[model samples]
Target chain A: MEKPKHKLLSFAYFLESSKVYNKIKKFVYDLIENDEYKYKRYFDIFMIFVILSSVTLLVMDVKRHIPHWLDDFDLYFVTTIFVVEYLLRMWVYSDIHKIIIDEYEESSYFDKEVSYYSLFTNIAKNKWAYMVSFSAIIDLIAILPSYRGLRVLRVFVLFRAFKMLRYTKSLTGFLYVLKNKKFELMTLLTLSTFFIFIAGIMLYVFEGDNENPNIHNLFDAFYWALITISTVGYGDIAPVTPEGRIVTMLIIFTGIGLISFVTSIIVSSFNERLSVLREDRVVQEVGKKKKLTVVCGYGLLGRLVVKGLQKEGVEFVIIDRSEEMAAVAYNDGYHAICADATKGTIFEKLGIDDRISHVLCLTSDDIQNAFISVNVKSLNSEVYVTARCSDQEIATKMEYAHVDQVIMPEEVAGMMGAVYAGEPVAFEVLLSIIEEKEKTHINEIAIAEGSFLDNKMIGEVDFERLRLILLGVFKRSEESKLGEFIFNPSDEFVLNAGDNLVCIGYSTAVANLKRKM
Target chain B: MQIQKDILLFGYGTFGRQLYKNLRSRGHKVKVVVGLDDYVEVESDSGVDITRINIKRNDDILALNVNAAESIFYCAMNKTANNLFLVLTLKSLYPQANVIANSNSNETTRKLKYAGATSVIDLYEATSRRIVNVLTKPAVSMALDEIVYKQNDLQMLEIELKENTFLEGKYVSEIKFRQMGIILIAIIDKELGYELVFTDHRINHKLDAGDILVIVAKKENISKFQEMLKKG
Candidate 1:
């Protein structure tokens, strides 16, 4: 009785300490860091919106007199939420450190176990680091009391608007672009600075002690130069003499050119960075999917395949050799890689062999198609390969290379033409099947083991009752013969365990049949 | 047979524009169908006034006499569903007209085919094939250069040896390919696969009756080689 009681006590303790600890850790971590978590995303978005609104309100309050009660309510509400967020972030600060340490500890240098005291010390150290971070400082400023008497205290409220940049992906992307183009931007900055300084000095020298009331001192001339060069000419400090006016005109033209140049640079950088971000997003999306098709080539056939896959709501990535084709694919809103598909490293980089279900080598060249087929097969022998061949010779070669399906476009075209000529109605039916014109469509449904329809005679089961038309049955077996398609099978045919029913009907009816089976 | 080849292009995107350019360059009369949202009167680079019809309304589709056009190209934007719907509508209106469509995938190729497209060009496959060919087959590129740029009469021919061919009993080294000014690239044997005969080891081997010699030579020399390989 004492043993059982002790065991129960220990179990309860374990439940209270370890389980609850983990639960709290996960909750806090999700709230603070995990953007992908649904609740966390919503919470973050709500906080961002709140920050934006409060910042806007504060800005307006400074411009004009807002009601006292409204101001107090907004301040208290925003501060309370921010205070709670800050505390939660602080609580999860140790977890973030642990995650970082765990991630890096795989390296030989970091393999030592962090003691409880060291962990506590480390958390404190990280907390200090976090407090000093740009976002953290902004958050603190947003929550801190703004002394009503002090005008400088009101300026801290504007930092809350900068907090929105942390939440918005595009703004972060813009910042990333700025970081990447820092060299060019720095050059532009230094040139503009030099021009402004020279123009200011020239104006100061030309207009000092002049009759013009506005250009009284070097400070005023410097101010005028800035205003004119930025193309924000307020006409406050006009140049009195022709020499001053000509210098001003020259400064204005340089400013216009500089502004345009900077604008163009920023726009181009934004585009480049955005494309990279989009590619990363595509990779992430593909990673989340269980099995995706990797299409090597974004040429005519590859483009068509991507469209078809997209229409069917299938996830796929396109690999193309040409930069132009890859760019086209990317613009078409498909994840694309502009690299040689023949390289085994490309497949490895894409994690194609691990997660890819199918690989379609739709390149027109027979040799390349064969190479891709062989390479993919070597990577993942289980991955289904479908290759397009120009002729029968290439088709034979592809078959010899172990490509599952070798499609000949000319042959298909010829067959399609023959079908069109010989049997128009059949062709129409085929078209209807392919296009899935209406509610009525063809689908392949497998009969699982122990299903009511499994091992039952076709005559015993009434497909008509379910509003399903059985077109054919495919019996898959390991012995004697491989899978055989029994087209328009008689009602007397017995359903096998591994038989697949190829039926035509409304989607609902097919689903109903599947459910019953 | 002399009927005017009036080409109708659906969707004025990249593929459609490319098709229009190719057709216009060949001096074919062509009209483009663009969505009402994107429709704008524009001139081709070659100074051909691009006739763009708005395809937003059913009336717009009806206004364009699709049946009168000799060929219709469905080289629309990347929207396969929209393209499929357009193909279906076009097929329903003019079943006899030769309709060509571009598909992005194999599944869409089937759908386009069944939708009554005379030919469905898989853009990805075609482009990939072209790129691969250009990269791997330098001889093909050279041949293309000769034909397209140089306008030379060079030809690459695959000559199959008959049972009693004049060259059947002789070794590859004794063929006097240098005298013929022809390059024997490889031999495709039925029993054995493609055997590239660059070095003396394979060249010294006796030629078989069923062997196919892949030879690259001038047009005149190809005929001469073919004649020499024929039975007496």
Candidate 2:
């Protein structure tokens, strides 16, 4: 019997001293610090719901009588959770202390391993520091018990709602914005205070207790001044004299302007903060997408490309050096980052390298486009690049840089002129195709491995019956041979599994073909 | 057709002045229309001449005798929307006259075309195309340059054969383009849904009725070819 007891005690000692303790401590630390943990995220959501309901019950209890059992049940349940969270946080801090000591030792910050007594003292100091932290104080207040019949102590229960602020990133960002604009806000506060004080003194001097029976004391005058300045006008106090009335009118107008000024300051700061948050959201969203197009410029050509991509429902991010242009793109419902695209790290920062399929450099400047092309290639060599060049020299240079396509607007225009001069009707048809204004659309439909069109002969399929014209067939094979484009193949031509049919037909007919494929 | 009066040039910016000089050098009379707010007297860079006219109202456009002028070139400043509006207004006024305008993008080019621009010169695209042509397709570009820039009067014509035409069932070699001094660039087979065949297949491929021929030759030769095919 004694041996068994001895063994059980030793087992308990081993559990406490083993790495299992540290692993469990790390798990709890992750729950507190990392929101990516699935269980932790669910727990956080559940806790938020519980806190909200508890606060609502507390508020309701103030106005009406709540059942004692329900109130007690809520208070006890939330307080118990709060206590457990607070203790867990403290335990994690202790684990952090051990980690710090180990790091210090590894770095030779201390010449030797510290004595047990010294380590204990250091941990005690760390614990003391954590106890005084703002969150820790709030946690303690949340779990504080209210004595029975001590009605005033129950107000501390509302402190539970403040815990929600810790989990809300946007609220913290708002607080940060407020802190950044503290000087401006303080100036407004000072101006309003001086105005109120002066107005209160003038009102008291113009209508003292002798003339106005409602005027009781200096504090009453100050209260009336505040109410008037806020435009609340509770109507509990009034000035009888004309001078006081004139002063009140002036005060009312000043209050109106000052209030608007304060509101404008808050609103502008909030908007600035919101843009920053939106930029972060864009980064996060880009991370989620498996394929994206990064447009490096927001000029006329860039805007046209963006519009086309938007019509096709393609995911893209616009990058421009001009803040105004970026803002314009953003307002136009595209994710835009205002940064120089020449910087190699910008792509990494935006996670553009993760799954970027295309990099379109459409800046007006040829040198900028070249730089962007090179940077994108260096960042991800597999990404296809298309750039706009102003001259033939730049086009050759871009081509040498392995850019897939170098477009020159002037050269294309000259070609268009030549085409117009040579074949006017054909030119119009081409223009209609590019403009997508014609009822007939030239669409490419791929034949899947088991598709109905796969392995079918051209003459076997009745395209005439469907009102679709097969313009070309691009056969892509697995052996890495260049795809062959058979333009208007013979009736005996066989359709392969990997063939992409470029058809010209009405939009409805094309849709039907797509459905059939 | 020779113009009796000077040509009217609208919007005397850089492009306008360049057009004025080019027309003047080419022995055509030229007049420039500046904005109403512009100074009446302005010096040219060459210090040889200055010509300016104000355009404040619609009558100003009419006063220029736009219909009688050789052509009106709207090489205004870089305001595409305003240029489009100007082209629309000009087209409304003189629907029969040739009015060429400059555009920036493909979209604007299409808009300008619909707005009745006789020839829309997208300067960027034109320059790019010229550069690309000079670099990649020198031979074709040289021919196009001669026709487009030099005004060689060479024509590109498409002819569709009728049923029972002599060309039916005849190989492309039988047409004898070399003897006729014409180039058969491609054949558009109607049976193949108008697919363009431009390879050596045209050398021995049997021609059929309703097969459209895309050929490039002088104006008179095209008509001669058509008459000979009709007689056959």
Candidate 3:
């Protein structure tokens, strides 16, 4: 954001500040690289078709006289695509305009001339970094098959197959598993190298002269040793002397031990990463949805809230700190993750975007719930958050954090106990309705504009006919612009558009009433 | 003459103190009893009688006039064992006393129900469920809060129908409770296996004797409705 010296001539800074350029760059980046992009699947599928046909055509070009048109197609049409794709990848690799502007600004601050040479070198350095990256190198080689002089490099056209690594996820997942087991794999590599060298030297010394035709030179002996250690048992090269056979036997046992060690390491690492992969898939799935409810705990209250949400048929994702509880929720057939809710980037990882409508923080710890609510409101102020607190002081803190609702379980329990003590049957009557234990739920039906219920008198809607008990109506007041609850509204209460009618009834009955509206 | 102390609270604890205050604020004549020596000494108020006794024993329970009291609340806070024993002893002795117990968990609620408690409040489940209700059904919860949980004249009163009542032989569709300006939420009848039959049930149930009507209304309206039921 630092202003360049004399903005007009500072073309780099001017380009850097252009919003359209940045947007286009981001669009192309998402199109090619962002896995969570909605349209990337179709893009990848198209590229897979292109890659298969290109490789198949190249393979057949050696013997069968492919039509000249197909050869020209591979040479011109395919190479142009490879070159353009490589360029686009390089362009989105990093912001070269920013690099040049930063270098220019630093040089000006030092009271020196803006050396165009330094800026050029800086831009080149960044481009080189991306060009040497693993995927970029594969991309560069994929274009080499078009050159006639580099016929040896033509064989490297098969390196085009490695370019498929960019499109396929399983290949990258395997690489990630191997990368996580690098330390154990390195140890195994060292142990195998040591044995291969020792066995190669002994084999040449014992069988090089006459006992074995396969062991003429040190290179041949080393190749035999490697094949034996790999447990391939090609048997093309066999040891004849007693000493060589003894070394072969020991190396074979070592080979088995080393192979098993490598397998277990990779398998365990994959097991550890499977949960991560599954969560990533869940996040991707959530990205495609809107108006998702994010439940931030998997405790008793969280379970109850999730159940209510399920009954309401709302889409929701859950996050909890305890792996066991999260696993319990996941096993209960809910999409849940063991993750810290207060982490700044967690919202993005959950793929909530701006579409998260509500967040329910029901963790046992009051401080954690408070922070979770605060974090959610910070990310999206429009999201309604309900947080649980154990005491009044923390409840006030939750309010300051702009939480929509603060639930104090102990205080609510105390009030409930009192209510039960004074009017036992009344408490049961209300609680049965509230808890839905009686198979009846309290629902709010909003009167849509121009609907049958709109602009009608309350008396016109027959309560006995609908078979739904009307509790009250929450009318949106014009002056205050807030919904006010009118308890036990009388028959004179005129039904207006935007009025929310609260009622108690069986779920099916409520749905029936809703259909009428 | 001494005012009738109609309510007895046993095993005073955190929830016990709150319940006592709530009952007192609602104009109920209530007394507290605790077996823990320290709780009795510390929480005992001068004006309110705080009796210290072994509530687990039947003799001590009877000594407190457990059966004579209209309602007995066993609020042992976290001690489920004492609550179970107290409920069992009082039920065994009185055989008809209304015993209400507060349990810390659903498991304890089941045990208390089995031990002959007339009503068992699962504090944990209630707290969690209230939070859930507030979260999932904001508008409905706020409406319920105004009339039910919050302090107001509006009350939920259960009126049982006796024989020869005007509404006894009428079908549910024929009777109009809403004409009295009270919402009849549900009907609990003994012959219906004690399950709450919501007012919105598809079947047009016939109103019979011994059926209790759960109605929500203002205090004066409730009294008016009771008088109308009695006269008609």
Candidate 4:
């Protein structure tokens, strides 16, 4: 019993080192970001405490009912968590080698590039780590004792918490738009500056140097100009003279123009970013899956392919240069890149060299599709490329390029239109057949030692129990090296430990058999 | 007492350097050409006009402190991103400068506007408009746009060399627009890299494709120039 207990402890340690543990850690990290559980509850409680502490501070300041213990308790609770979080983050950063390899390391290839360097420093320097992280920054600012002794920072902290709203899909979509249209927004800000600058100068000249000593110089004038242009006119600074009033009027007019410009930029940027978010979500389901078909075009025909692929969870990348058409794929969370896929440069830029098992060139242009088919072959001969051709003559060209399939969208549309118009039930039956076929498909299973089918003859294995049919036994002779295998062995052949069995069955049946002895 | 406005030209490109000399000679209010990158940084021996920004990011436009000036002429032919980026950033950061800029295209003009450009002018468009004016009303337009005085009977014409025009082979005076009541002011022929004009030195220069000819003429004789241009 002691030996078994010790073995269990060591086995647990072994499990920790495996990819499964890494995957679990990643999922947990994602969960924390989502803030759906433990962190969200903790945050809500902390927020309540902050609010209560602020109320208490206000009451005490006014010489009202004051509880010293409440103040101490709030301070201690906030400080303790802040310290703990800081320490934990530091510890994690110190053990970063165990969690994630450095980017310079070859093994770090799969890891995402961390966008914020400040976050890394907090993890590196254990002191006040949580206080510096984006959310924590807000918290620290909110609790600072400078004005109202740091309670002023709470408003900022609330704003930071509002950013956490990005975790919600809808809010995240909005934020994504904001980030994507950064340049456009920047442009609007730039344009507004000109008006502000001119207005500032006019105010300074007209208002006089003696009255507003702050506006004696251009920088002061500029500061006033920005505030005035932005319409955030703090009454601390005001123009006194009649000339200053005229300048103020000019500044106000310019402010209107600047506001309109900024609004337009944000609106355009929002739409652009939203479209991109929708595209990315489309292909999120097929991550790391194999034997997926990548269809590059998104047209009336492309929709059919997407519907079929989505039903089967088949991995794919959709390449459509048109932003409007690609918006559909984006909404679905599919891997979509906006570029002229017909260009060879796009392939090089996208790094789509040979990783793809299959390619579907379904662009409307027959010549372009044929060109891409040939290009795909040149890039990777083994990739099973299919193309859509408008003309039947292009079929010969597609064949010359060694395309696995040539689908004519017009022909298919005509057939579908006729069938759907004449017999709705027949169309439904066809759809049902496709759905059934996708749900159950042939997959190869590798034989392992001590497995039930390891030494059994093909006929001896109980296929009836599995609700599966033995498609073929792929066997490699002992004399032949790796990568050399014979397909569809005879029924008399005994299944060896190393042999791969190609079986056709429902997914559930295949999964059960794979798990069973 | 006449108070002089001290103007600073930051870039020393064709427009920057030209505006500097042009404004200076006239004596209205012109100072010096300040060159920071490769060009000389002009500052009075006693006075160094400087403005500081307490921000982490370095902006091109704000650094120039153009808003502090009565007028700033920036014709730095630097990277569009570097130039407009700095300009627009400065406009946002400091909104006190009257910035008159030179842009390359319509797209950039739009960008310049958004970046807080007070006034944006395209070099190509300005040159094109000058050419169109000269060709249409050589006498009146040239005196006003180019020569700036009625006494200096100078006019500018930007002509696109036709595929089979006789003047393609001949030099400026040899092909002679004077025969059509036009005086050639300047020939902007890229074949030679620099714009050749009817100056005292380079009067008999050659013409080529994409050459813009700036001509000068009297107000009454400019109509004859149109007839000559239409004939061949």
Candidate 5:
């Protein structure tokens, strides 16, 4: 499936032939469009700074006298950067030579001469698409004011503020909210325009000529109608006639109606986005943590898992459909969001494939857990997913979906009952130990590279003196994941770096041993 | 030492089957009762006795004789209504029998208790607690799996101190359980209404007769300790 890279023919592939040129072009493309690139974020911040400073200099020039050097720096230095940015954006929009050669190579089957003309159009189309793009137009006009030839268009420098939209995300979110309600806004705009036109004509008829000195002409009547309908009521000119006064009341009432209608539309748009904003905040918080566990339910089981995870100091997000349940987790100061977790695309939205180390499907409904585990495994095959099922049939389905850990609560409860009946005291001891209520724990501490415990033999550290029992060691190697647990390791066993020491002790003893790790 | 009791379990589902296996493996004679329509999984174990009856009729349940059973489990995790009715019927039938009901939710546990189940095992809470342990305390869960479920030499036992036992009248702080190759978690005092007073701290309480001590140790060490208690 590998494509042949050798260039066969002439000047059409000349630019593509240079590997360095292609490499540089790809880097610029990444800077311009790739959201994951580190330099792209830095580039955005620098651009934002340039736009802000340029706008600030312009504002200062309006009243206070800015230094000439500062003015020249703003007018020339900022314009050059804007021009360079525009050119780079246009260049990265599409690879011109690749398009030309690809079209030429394809058209060799048909009309070769016609492919030349088509190729010309193809290149023009790509460049023109970039040229007329909203951001592109803003980039161009933002720099045109610095040209001595375009002094008449000097006011266009304010477009630099519009350029700020390209860098900031929250500003773009505002535009998205308005764009979603475009249809309703347009209908309202049409209705208001119709009322304004009719009111302007009615005012002209009621107060034309000597009937009212303010409404001498149609322009004046229309201007009065505009001011009255907007609820501005400049009162520079008033209609003295009784008919015109009635028309004024109608215009004022219509303004109030349109204002309320517009207010409702905008308010509803924000209301819809408010939930999304909270979800986004949770998503952003998840992105910050190194190891994240995404629990898709906040019921009783979810609360139990959350408490254990909290004690372990693990970063996790709680997602639930019920507001009160999610609120229970949210109020507890954990990252929680009220949203349905069974949606197909929800895992990708949560960025589970990247930072999530575990996905817990703890919803009570078996079918819900199945759907969630399937979604999680589909998104990230490597992520360890644990799902709780109530029965054996659904447990089979969950395992079939490739869940890493399929938990049957009934089976667990049955085992608990048997253990309790057989060894009630043992069950109580194990339960308290598992729940960590008695400050006893069986914990694992990883030996980091260059740590004090690294390269030390197991016998060197006095685990007995530390009041802990060494259960085993989990050595991680590049070949295997998490490695295998070596049970009852010999005293002469050398403790290497990146080995996890599994021990059973009180929490303080574990903490003491971990101090060396 | 444990005197294995006869366990009578009613219902046929995942919970019932699982509990059946668990109790049977613990050397207890288990009798499983299922409805006529129940699909029972085939097992050839001689220790189990399965019977099919139309449990829908209250007279059939009333006529059912489980007088020999000391321990009864009502596992209607699939049918909450059945557990409620069965627990009520059984409570009337055997007033002093130990009836343990397995329920999927907390609310069901409460309702089963109201119907006179001596104890209700919350299926959700138990499983969730296990899962939490598996995730947060992997080593602990692994150790339990090795010794407890795997039936190894090392075992956990709860010893109820008999009158004039070795541990009687001794403060909890006076004993070093770990030196005997045992881990002591708590002491449940019968006089204090059976609360688990953790031994790690708050160790001022005197160990009384009839108080239960939860400890984990090897089988031989446990037997030796119990022998010492008997001779005390």
Candidate 6:
């Protein structure tokens, strides 16, 4: 019997469904961190979508604004889906005991207590949760008191469609404004309400007589005071007495200060959110996604290697055990996973056993490389491995492990020392230039078989016109005997078909050479 | 003694307090630090005794300013703008001082180095160095690189399930091979984490997109596993 196609498609479906949940989580984080009223813009957009969808569903269900029909089934179906969603959220929360106690055993007591707070904050944090949560509330609003007689609330479900606007950038900006200035605005609101109350009471006493029709009771006085403070003078309520007129004049001047205070609060709030939004957008745009390359130990030598890789535009992931060092890397916009590399669990967590292409072991200890080389080969034999060793013994052992390359740091260092001693002027000149100007880097290009230089000799290649200096030629010929160091040879030294020419010059010079060639 | 190429100083205290410690670490030659204080003392690595020196005089500054060993790092943390002013003023007074200051921005690196830093090294680059360090020593597999494993006698197998299949009960050790190979490491069983470590043995663990199996054998043995799914 053939296996069910659904069973085969289950994994893909599972991933596809989880994508929505992941997107929701990302949206929430963006919402919390968003500085602008981008949330509000998103909310507006989602609401529009919701409204349109609702209208279509309603039109399909009712056909006419009359009583029930077969079309009414669509409204019931959508409402039923929403109801199931609400139940699932509550059901997911029911497993809270297992989720917190089982999953978060290492968490502190305060973290456990605040874990509940995380749920609520998470609602405010994500775009979908923030939207769907409000939508969920609206869903409840539409579903409860399920009597056909109450049609108005059901119609309000059409407005609930606007809830989808939670996904848009502007809605996020709006929410950001609300979130950041919540306390300040709350204070301003309390003061405004209190002043309105005081004005209301005083006006009620001062304008008690029937001379002023608008200021009949305490409620009317509040209405007038609210209008005046808000700078919206409807002129609907006027105080007739001389004392009442003086109070009104005083209230009008207070309006200016109140307005300025509220405006200032909102502008600063908006500015803060706007800046954060821009920063998030930039990070998201710049951060590339590739299978992570886990760098285990970061020391002096490691730093240079990393800098070179970064310059060459390689996407690599880093794992350093040092907390302070990790903080610095993270601050610089590098995704650094902090864990011990020697452990099998870290490699498993990083998904390196399957996805990795190469492993570079450059720790100070040669023994560690020898050991890790074996582990990496055992884990994934197809992966290429390179190790750094100062000890020749360990280097030989590493080679036995099939390490593609073994770099000897001590040997390189000795070579450099000898070079400096023998050619002090050359070494000093290079170091001074690198330190002083930080300009003019080197480019080493190889001559390919198809190139114009296939049969040409050194003197005929127009080296100076290309504005490049041929430092050396790495000849690969059975007839001749030069490997990587054939320097300043005679003009008759033919550029072999597979010879690699090492040229050192600035980037512009290399570009000009390529263009000319 | 060879001059240290790159040295990082954490704090900017009195020149004397930092200078002597640096001198002891660097030996006799002048040392520079970024800070406002001036007390020089050379303490043992044991951190038990302290020797103080009064080098507040102009001679000391001039000596440190010109010494080839002197690479001063400004350690002030409170206000970056103030730190810039202090560093630039010191540079103007002593153009020979190879000044290195803690900076928050790229613009600051340019301005400080231009103002007169022999060369400005970002303390953050130390952070960058840490990342570089990690990259250099990436988590590597031992078996894949070893000579015992690399010879034709050994092979590494990474089997991924394109579709779900029931093959859990069969012993991996008993699996027939097209060529003689050994099943040394099984990654998929461990990747599910500690919960499924050794319990509820159904012998048939269904494979998924994330399911990975690492097997080792001779070169000829791997083709058998590949052929089970009908490759050739």
Per-candidate TM-score against the hidden true structure = 0.53, 0.63, 0.87, 0.37, 0.78, 0.40
DockQ pick, better of 2 and 3: 3
- Per-residue lDDT tens digits for candidate 2, residues A1-517, read 4564345445545655779776887788888756445467666787788778787887888789899887787767777788888888887776543444454455456555435555456767888899998778987887664444766667777777888777765677777877878999899889989989999999889887578888877788899899999999998999899988998998899899889998898889988777567777776667667777888898877876777677666678989999899999988988998888999766886665567877888898999999999999888888878788866677898999999767766444434433443344444443433345556544566777888888888878876567665555677777643265554556678888867776555678878877877
- What lDDT does candidate 4 reach at residue A189? 70
Q: Model 4 misses residue A244 by how many Å?
A: 3.3
Q: Could you give the candidate ranking by DockQ, starting with the highest? A: 3, 5, 2, 1, 6, 4
Number of the top candidate by TM-score? 3
- lDDT against the true structure, per candidate, is 0.66, 0.68, 0.78, 0.53, 0.76, 0.51
Per-residue accuracy of model 3 over B1-232 as CA lDDT, tens digit each: 0123367777555566666666677677777788855354243343776888876577777787654446655555447787888888778887887788887656777899999988776655655555556655667777877876778877776777877778877877777667777888878766776666777765666778878788888878888877777776
Give the higher-DockQ candidate: 2 or 4: 2
Candidate 3 residues lying further than 4 Å off, grouped into runs, are A1-10, A17-20, A58-65, A148-152, A351-353, A378-380, A420-424, A478-482, B1-21, B29-65, B68-70, B73-117, B124-136, B159-181, B187-213, B219-232
Better of 1 and 6 by lDDT: 1
lDDT for each residue of candidate 1 in A1-517, tens digit (9 for 90 to 100): 4465345445545644577777987888887677555577677689788877777777687679888877886768887887888877777765543434443343326654434455456657778888887678887887765446776777777777777876766677777778888999999999998888899888888877766777777788888888999999999888888988999999999999999999999999877766467566666667767777888877666765676577657678988888788889988988887768888876776676578878888776778988999999988888878887765677898888788767655444323322332223333443443345445555667778899988888778866467665555667778622255554455578997767776656678777777876
Which stretches in model 5 have alpha-carbon errors above 4 Å?
A1-23, A26-41, A109-111, A147-152, A319-333, A336-344, A445-464, A469-501, B6-17, B27-122, B129-137, B149-232
Q: Which ten residues in a row have the lowest lDDT in candidate 5 chain B?
A: B68-77
Select the stronger candidate by DockQ from 1 and 5.
5
lDDT of 5 at A419: 73
Worst 10 residues of 4 chain A by lDDT: A414-423
In model 6, the fraction of reference contacts reproduced equals 0.01
**Comparison by lDDT, 2 against 3, better one:** 3
How do the candidates rank by lDDT, highest first? 3, 5, 2, 1, 4, 6
Candidate 6: segments with Cα more than 4 A from true spot: A1-48, A52-135, A142-148, A151-162, A169-184, A204-209, A213-219, A264-288, A291-311, A314-425, A428-517, B1-232
DockQ scores of all models, one per candidate: 0.03, 0.11, 0.42, 0.00, 0.35, 0.02
User: Which one is best on DockQ?
Assistant: 3
| Per-residue lDDT value at A315 in model 3 | 82
Which window of 10 residues has the lowest lDDT sum in candidate 2 chain A? A414-423
List candidate 2 stretches off by more than 4 Å.
A1-45, A63-69, A83-111, A114-140, A145-153, A166-170, A186-264, A277-288, A319-350, A371-383, A396-404, A457-471, A479-494, B1-101, B105-116, B119-232
